[model samples]
Target: MTIDTLDIAASPMPATVPKRSFLQEVIEDTPGSDPRFEMCIQCGTCGGSCPSGPDMEYSPRRIFAMIKADMREEVLKSNTFWYCVSCYYCMARCPQQVHITDLMYTLKRKAVREGYCRKSTASDAPDFSEFFADAVLKYGRSFELGLATRYHLRHHPLGAIKMATGMGLEMMRKGRMDLTPRRIKNVDQLQAILSKAEEIARQEREQGGVA
Candidate 1:
């Protein structure tokens, strides 16, 4: 009846859950196409090829490094994505074809949503983008006048008056500006599609999964 029990220290430990890095989180949260952020090789090509490189707080590769290090707050607070002109030059030049531009766009949306964009000098870009998106959701098309009016008035009241009087009048006179937004045909259908897309995005964000 001599039964010896195995030592607890020698026994297998329970499986420990591994924490995900910011890079993995970004890849998971990226919708539509798979993000190749993990493919980044620390090359300086992306940084050198950016047209607005000088304006950014961090180069794309450096940002990728930060993401790898799980520096979510630092990455989101950076003006790097805002300065990305979306010219695609960096993506074009990268030997890895790492979806640089798309990643930048994703970061932009994430930063704005998380309220990290307010401390940025380029924060107005997010506000204007929101106004433009609201107009599209409302009319199934952009209302340039309304968008500009709302954005400028909120950011620069004096400049808004000047812009309304100056270039705004000229554009209206030239028939390039309209008093109202023209609704696209089958606008309800468009809205439904857009709403569905939004629903998918929300689900992806919440689940931290890719589309």
Candidate 2:
């Protein structure tokens, strides 16, 4: 992991401008969040603090090392960032105060935009997130039955049918899974808030303050 001894290789991602290193690209990609990826010391602290580290294709610490190595293909296609639960334990415990959680978000965006998420083992993460977000925006509350039905149908049609006939029916019988979604009391207010946030984000992107 020593910079002097490490062998540098061409990144799978396209080079740009004066040619930015993968590390610099990551830092730039997460603008405003200020992910201090360069400050990583290979202490293994982030990996140790991560609850999902064991399930990741690469641990957080290793992902950092790979990032510095300019292993764009490997890093972006990894399950490390996708499996992150955003619990913030890793970020809080890092001596360098690397924004581990925020960095994961940055990486997730890169993975999705670059089409790497589709090639990843944790590819379902994005689909699940999209379903959840859609539910929230439409109903102002999570519709578990709809979420499960849609997710299962898209990923596992057979499982979806089985669930609808079996576990799903039981959940509905017990009132755990409602057949319909419920709107919040003030849906317009929520929409206004979300719209304002999106507007600010759009402005930030125009200013190169967000990527």
lDDT of each: 0.86, 0.87
lDDT of 2 at 181: 92
Off by more than 4 A, model 1? 1-16, 207-211
- The prediction achieving the highest lDDT against the true structure is 2
Per residue, candidate 2 scores C-alpha lDDT tens digits across 89-193 of 998899999988888988998898789999999988888888988899887999898899889899989989998999988988898878889999998899889
Model 2 shows how many backbone clashes? 0
RMSD of candidate 2 to the true fold?
Answer: 6.6
Q: Give the clashing pairs for model 1.
A: none
lDDT of 1 at 18: 68
Give all TM-scores, in the order shown.
Answer: 0.85, 0.77
TM-score of 2: 0.77
